[model samples]
Target: MNPYLIVPLLALFLNLSLFTYVLALKGKHRVVHLYLLYAGDLSLWIISIVLYWSFLPIHWMPWIFKISSISWLLAGTLFLEFVFAFLSKNPNILLYLLRGLALAIFPITLTTDWIIGGVERKYWGDMLLPGPLYVYGVNVLIVTPAVYAIFLLLYESRKEEIGFRKQCYLLAFGTFLTSILGFLTTILPRILSQGDLHYPPLSGSASVIQSLCVFIAIAKYGFLEIRLEKIALQLYSKLREGVILLSTADELLYWNESAKEILGFSKSSSAPEKLDLGNFLDGFTRKPFTRMDFKKKSESPAKEIRIDDETIYSTGPVYLEVSKSEIPISGRDLGKVYVLRDITEKKEASEKINMLYSRVVRDLDIAREVQNTITTRTFPDSEKFKIFSYFRPYDHVGGDVLNCAESVDGKIEILFADVSGHGISSAMVAAMASISFNVVSRKGSKPKEGLLFTNDLLSSVVTQHFISAMYLRFDPKTLILEYSYAGHHAGLLLRKGETLDLPGKGGVLLAVGTPILEDYQIQLQAGDRILLYSDGLFEVRGSKGIPMGNTTLVEAVKKLSYQDSDGLIRSLVSYSESFGDGIMTDDLTLFCLEISESA
Candidate 1:
């Protein structure tokens, strides 16, 4: 055995392994298939050389030499096809001409000796002797296409990104090196020495360098689509989200481990290689997904899928937020990339929050109903006075409360209170205040004593909150009004078309402090009216941030004093709403009373 035969043997082994590996890949692109054709040609060339050097019969040398020449002749054409595919470029007229020439000369080389005349016996092995058309064949069929492919690769390298450019440069360098070594060791020597070269052809051995270079490019820089697909598969398998790749024809190109798990494929089950996307989805759900279903899903605005088949998924339920995007190469639609993220936990949590919110809203509605029942009362229909009340809460439930009771001694007791805050907590306090007011009124306590008792009850039970209230008592026989304030605004007394403030001093907020409630007495005349309200009326601020102060309310009351009790209260509320631009920041309550002339 010649020791020099080891080189071509090694080249043969490497190229055959690369070609087999590429062929065995599941989903291969055009560039990878082209590379497989190129590598198979090189492996054939190496195998011919390896057989030529072996101890074969002497008569077979010519046949082996012709096969080797034919392999070399096809090498350049296959490599150019691979280069054009890799660069995503269409074949030009030059490529078509080269292909035509290679195909035309294929039969001639097999039948005649125009390209490979004969084989010469050398010390190492048999060398191919150049024929009459050998130089033209080598230059036009082999060297021309290889050089052109390398030039195109170099030109494309300049326009590519750094990673792809490195891959291009490596492939170009490998092709250039293979061409140079083959030309020097085989073609150049054969042409120069006129078939008297001492050494056998080593172009088969030189192909090993190109193979190794392409391997390096694939391993490190992802030169071929095969490497990128492998890398994408690895990354997708490790992701928590499921990923599925499909060709434009709905062929299942690739699916990661996560996708298999999400689609309910057991570990022991073997997935079919030729399974279409529609069939895969059909197995995943109860209803089969048709081709049109997949197309609509890819184009639809709503891109979510809910899978609740207990038989498919051992778990309770699966909610997937699915998105699809088209994979395009050089403006050509290659495939679709489908990503599915499990949102079961997120959906469950949102449902829990909504449930709690609904429960709270229902409770608030019931509380509002109860509060309206307690606060809305029929004031004593007395001949001496006509009483009217209005209440509006900022929310479903509020802090402001109003209550009126007629004592056995013909004393009409009225209480208007505003708790510190809004919502459920304040509404609770208002309820407590209403009960306390009724209890104190039954005891026939004076206006000042009633407030003192109510403040003491609230201060002991409530924390971080206080109440502001105005308590009024009117004796119909004496025509005298008595009022006391607990950190509350003064009441308005309307007499002879003029507004007067029924002011009281030394009042403090209830529940938080001891109130120094002073009793204020007003000599009520026939046809005179009085109005008491919570601070929400005048504290309202408009768009300009100006509060509608008590002075404004007094002026407005004087202008509207001619209306009856119901009309007066409604008109006042409407005026305040207009002043605040229909935005309420706090609860509002108004109580109005008119003294009849017949009294």
Candidate 2:
């Protein structure tokens, strides 16, 4: 068995296998199928070359070379036809007729030494060259068709798919180089070496290498149908959101991986019959579809489907959309391909984003806790100083700090400070100031001394944005009430049927870097009473659009002096609320202390 004969037979088998694989591949284009068929012709030529060079006998050599050469010519002609079919609207008949003519010339050359002339036998092998009309005719037939094939390939590659064109060009260039090298290295060298020359045979490996490289290029780049179609199919299957494809027969043709996960379907195939699709999606409360008969040519392709009462935990119904399109078949309508995309997550996210402020409802609950800690919690013993306090914060939280405590001298110290700003941040500062007030009062300082201490601490600790307050201390035994102001509104003192705005010029507010110099003293008699309040209680604007100034506050206190401390705070709140037209913008806090020997 000759090695060359066996190699050609094997190469022919491999080539046929590749061509068959191309036909088996599923794709949309007929031109692609034609190109693969042409490539098969080239494979046949390569195999024929192997068989011809196997050196049977002298009598068979010329006939074998003639047939193999004719096969090569047909392969090159097919290559051009493939390109013309791919690039142009139709095949060029003139080129086809010329290719037929070239084939006809092969038989004529065989009979007479007209085309290939005669084969001359040498020691190594036999060589075929042109003679007479066939001498230039062979060159014309081969080179003319080859040049045309090259040009057609160039033009087709430009018009075809980007990746496909690249692969085709790669295959064409590699084939050209290999064919040139095969002829030069084997045939030309053997002829030029004259009779005694023996050149190493150019192995069938050149065509094999070229074929494999082109096959790889085709598999990786040219034949994209399998890869792209697989991706499309997989995406339709695996999407977690519901997906449904409705075909021409009003039938469900496809579903995706996630369609089942979200839409509550089992592993039963994604495609449901049209009736089944309706049944599966029946529970949804959505706008009526125009008809259950899936329209192949619908004016609109997308619509939202709403599902109500889906689950107990859901905030509301879930919404989904079906995107539909007509799947175009060459002569047949494949109905509408519909995709069901569950947009439940997107809807939920959008709703959550819209009501972002709802989180503040939770914060309001926290604000209530802060109010409890800052207000009544500061002084637990209401029994000690006959202390009566009313604190009402306007918003969820406001800037108000109130204090009541017994000093070392048996005097009751009380004050209300208003910090600037609002919301949680201001409320926080107010809480801190409340704690500071209690701490300083327990330090056993006079009303003024405590005020100075608090002011100093607040000045260091708080921001300049806050306002300081008034502190009042009443000594029951001494009948002396002392007060200190830190940039606070005046404290009202009512005596002898006249309104007295006790003069209070104070140091800068606490937490503000201002000098601590202002303190005032007052004589407390048996019938005199004092009002300690946040500015919110007095400076509040009335319906008449006037702040309830010191004069009006003094008058209100005069009438309320006879009431107990609790009654006094209530009366003041009522009065302030009425004056402000029932609008409380700031936190209102008040503590009233009346001097009575009977208590």
Candidate 3:
């Protein structure tokens, strides 16, 4: 088998595989499917050059060259079509002109030796020269459009996503390299070496290399489908937050329009390799330009520069948050990234985010040992009752709170209060309520009296929010439980294998300063179980986003009342999570108290 014949056969198989593979991997987009047509035609051109130039008889070789060259002509046309569509451009005039020119010269080139002509025999094989119509056929139809496609790749890459633009850059370089190698093999070797080298015969592999580079871009990075909208270029540059990308040596490689505007650069100014950080020091007035100065100012956070003077965007001093991070890892240093955020617009929101960030760090350490935190448990000195409770907020601080007081008299006061909302503000109100309840209890007031005094305290302090509460006083000797609710869910009681709601007279929500209605009473017996919970328990959303109602809560309490208080709370939490598909939408609080006959 001739080595030349084997190379063409391999190229034929590779292009065939590429055509089918590109079509199959269309990813529901038709851009690459059209490019496959080019690959198919190139495949045919490779096979045609072998048969017409080498394998065929001398009599048929000249005419066969003209006909076989049509596939190569179509291959170039299809490649240009692919480029236009890939860039989301309409190819109306130039594309049609190329096609028409190729069709018009096809018959003339086949009969007369005006296009391909008779090839000159070179070192290994025959070399075909561009004949009389080479300018119209090859230059106008093929070479011009191929060069234009490289420029199109570069232009489109600027508006693409960062990672994808990088892929496009590599792909464009491959296209350029393939074109250079093809030129070197065909036109360069022919002009420089004369009839010494058969460069034209070996040029088939360059097309295959081009196709492989294109296929890699398509299959690996999804270059065809994932191009960013071109409008984003203007928007990215026009964003209020300034973005600057610098090299390892603190040279500015790229900066957005906002950065240029903030840095006092005119719109017409071009990028400089080394930006003066000394000039930036005046903008960042608080900290010195040195890293040692930054370390002395703040140890943890990257400092923000406050731009107080009137500028383009704001009339008041704009507080711009400065954030710097290392760019994505590469062998070549892409430098560090610096971002400036306008935190002046919403001072409250910025403060809240900072406060939340601080609380998150503080709570992480506090949560590690929450043994004596907000949800601490205590039992009355009586052996008749055993109580266990659980509380967990969505954040570090919570509105749900519980306080147990063993009164000087033969009374045990248990108060469970839920502020109207979650977070720091609500927690503060809950804390205030807890303190008032303790103060009222110390004065030897009844559960109703303490609740009334607490409501008045809430109305004075809490604004734009309210509290829901249940105050209970239990007499272990008499087995009497008296409770009063202020806009709270009724307590649940499990007695004699049935669940019962301890419906109590309800008053207005506490922070409104309304007087409590008459308290409700329930006589406790042996084997009686009582549950006090925040609405967050039953308000848990399921997979369908529907809240678990009180009916579900009653059933859960009745079924799991046999377990100890800790086990019961844990089991109920587990059950709620099972219904919710493990998504926690709100805080949870559950308190279980069981009466034992043996005790």
Candidate 4:
């Protein structure tokens, strides 16, 4: 309400509002809040001056005087923090130690009168005589940091651009201006005039110089190009993902820390607005990164670069994935944000995985060759019988066996087996079963005897494993087809185009126990064909997701009556696969034999 209080009250309101506004901008620019905190404290010191220079309640003068010194202490402490950060110095021990000392001094000054001695009223206003240790403590904790800050600015300004250098000079000038004014108005007038004439209001005038720093600090984010909001800038700076603000007019508006380090280069020091897009890519690629294809006006999909070689300006030497999105303001391309992520560990690990995968594939190829040699046998070289064999493993190698051989006595012996499970172990069982079959068949044994020999051969060696096999002995002269099986699929006899099942009327699985082989005999007519297959061929799921049994296989064989032995086997596998929805349940094998009229 007083005339002198008007300007001070207005200054107080303006500073408080500024503090709140800058606090809002903290998410955009963290240091902005520190600047406002310092400025707010300075304003509080001014309010104390306004109170003293007016007709205040006399009792409030001492408390107001004490608080003024408190504001001075806070202003100096907060300003030190702001200055260190503005210089791009990260949080270090030295900074925290200095801050610790300031905090330590804070509790002492609040309780004791080491900072504010006593207040006396003059004709026009009140004067607070300096405390005993106030001058030294205030000068040491507050003014000294500010003086050192000016020297630091000048020293570091050497490598900076013209604009940065100008900002530094302006900031240094403001510091000196405040210090000179404080000495002149707070101390000199009282000492020189040798009277009780003391006016601290003149000390508050130093605030004009401090405003210069705030103005200069605003210019630091490149000439007020806050087109990228403070939130965006803060987010961009903190993120490992970078943000690059390139104005629609080809001007560089912003480049975050990650953008500079990851992209290799930054905006021109001589001309910040004029950025070479080519230079921008140096951070991501070892070679010249010329893939400038995403020039779409709207937001673009992310693009990845897997540089197997060296990289520049990056955190690691291995790999990087970079993406750019055009910043659209009001549906117009205002700039671009570049997000960079370091995929070095993932890239190296993937390369190792691929190398391991290649080795696995190579090993599987060798296993496949060995399994092929063991599972498949030479077909009988005969004129009366046409034997066709089919084998397919679920993956790399299979556990299904198909073999046929003609004995010296003109009797053809055939063996087909499917091991219990799939993969390398089962394929090994199939391989061993084929060897046993070949050895017994060459010995001129009957189908049942050959089955018994194979059962004994696998019983001791195969643990947690068994074989379901069918052995066949066909006499070309007699046209007598004698087939025996052990826990295997029944033979399909297609006699004059009518499907007939031999049934699984056999013994226990081979390797589980001795097998009492039951032979099923069928006389070959003018045109008779028999289908022998492993359980893997007939034990897959049907169209309704039901397990396909031999009956369904025989039905499929019936449907393919028009097909020859080879065509029918091919269609059998195709139909079985269709029911599985393109997935394989087990290793598949189908062995077929047709009798020609020459027999």
Instruction: Sort all candidates by lDDT, best to worst.
Output: 1, 3, 4, 2
Q: What overall lDDT goes with each candidate model?
A: 0.74, 0.59, 0.65, 0.65
After superposing candidate 4 on the true structure, give the runs of residues whose Cα lies further than 4 Å from its correct spot. 1-10, 26-36, 57-60, 84-115, 120-124, 148-176, 187-201, 219-243, 247-273, 276-335, 338-599
User: Candidate 1: lDDT over CA atoms?
Assistant: 0.74
Model 2, 100-184: lDDT tens digits are 8778877776677675666665433455655566435534554455566666667756633334465557666766665565566
Per model, state how many residue pairs clash.
0, 15, 0, 4
Q: How well is each residue in 551-595 modelled by candidate 1, as lDDT tens digits?
A: 898889889988887888999999999999998889988888889
The order of the candidates by TM-score, greatest first, is 4, 1, 3, 2
The TM-scores, one per candidate, come to: 0.41, 0.36, 0.40, 0.42
Residue 241 of model 1: what lDDT? Answer: 78
- The weakest ten consecutive residues by lDDT in model 3 span 290-299
Better of 3 and 4 by TM-score: 4
Compare the candidates by lDDT and give the number of the best one. Answer: 1
